[model samples]
Target: MERLNGYKHLILGNHDRGHSLAWWLNVGFDEVSEHPIIYKNFFFLSHEPMYMNKHMPYVNVHGHIHGQKYAGVNYFNVCVEHWDYTPLTFEQIRDAVVPSEEQA
Candidate 1:
């Protein structure tokens, strides 16, 4: 993997478990997690899609499904295939999901 300029956090996926946590850190990930983590009390970041209902307050941003999308308004697939092979900023994601008036 190419070295990225900002803080790199990795949420381990099924394939990522083949290596040790230290190995991932050495490869340039600043932080590593074995499970889903909540960000800003609304975005649930994870490697795989977590179950969500329409009434749920949090939006799940995940990637394990690749080209396929999880069926829910609260699910955002960060898979490269969905974004023309480019990563998106948190602001872009936030704006796409939450209206500016609703954002804090």
Candidate 2:
């Protein structure tokens, strides 16, 4: 994680319970969250995919399932396996959920 640049935020998941919250922060995460957080008012960023249906306007970008997909199109899998071990940029994720024409 130290090799990576920019601000790092860690969202605690089911498998991340071994360490104390302080331990994570001390490792250099800019922000550590125990719960899912909304980004840009629509993206629900979490370690596990939350419920989402086509009727909902928000998108859930999560990673607990690895390469397997959740039920809804609104659920995006950002696990390392799915992304070929490369982290995705916010713009890349935003452009995927919102078409260029709609962005304007």
Candidate 3:
């Protein structure tokens, strides 16, 4: 929580059980809606990747799964073990998702 001080926080509905406690501690929660966040690029944040497909014009960012996988559509799992946050740029995540041409 100290790390995120001063920065705005938002929570998804599918968040795990302990989120309520965080909310009570004065965190933020914005009901996942069709409207997407368009900073740099359209970005969507959710607990599950499945829900991301329901909307469009946005790149989905999720963190329910411990592992990461990319299908070249629109999904990025930024969940890291032990670390409460992941500091990765979109380009970094894109590189991780897209396979190298040599591999293809």
Candidate 4:
């Protein structure tokens, strides 16, 4: 993973348990979370898609939705099955959310 030159953050999945936030941080993650976290005030990161609506201020990037690609208008599914098994960068995520909100 060190081959990649960028920041890395961890959001716990449902199966992740018995570990403290400090444990993850000590393991080398820039940031560690056990629940949804907002990124750059534009992205909602989570293990499972949630809080998706047409009225939110940020888009959701989640995993449990799997190959669905998107769970709703503001959701971007980043499950391994959907992304060819790679992490989505900030640029990739911004590029995915486009059109600046169209009629919906």
**C-alpha root-mean-square deviation, each candidate:** 1.7, 1.4, 6.4, 3.3
Q: Relative to the unseen true structure, what is the Cα RMSD of model 2?
A: 1.4
lDDT of 2 by residue, 2-93 (tens): 99888899999998888988999999999999999998787889999888868878889999997576656687778889888899987898
The TM-score between candidate 1 and the true structure equals 0.89
Model 1 per-residue lDDT tens digits across residues 1-104: 56456778999999999999999999989899999999988899999899888877899999998758766778888988888988788889888888788977
Tell me which of candidates 1 and 3 scores higher on lDDT: 1
Model 4 TM-score (2 dp): 0.78
Show the lowest summed lDDT stretch of 10 residues, model 3.
27-36
User: Which ranges in model 2 have alpha carbons more than 4 Å from their true place?
Assistant: none
lDDT of 4 by residue, 1-104 (tens): 46655777889987766788888777777887887898888998888878776878888888887546654668888888877877778778777676646423
Ranking by TM-score: 2, 1, 4, 3
Candidate 4 lowest-lDDT run of ten: 95-104
TM per candidate: 0.89, 0.90, 0.49, 0.78
What is the C-alpha local distance difference test score of each model? 0.88, 0.86, 0.54, 0.77
TM-score, structure 3 vs. true:
0.49
Clashing pairs in 2: none
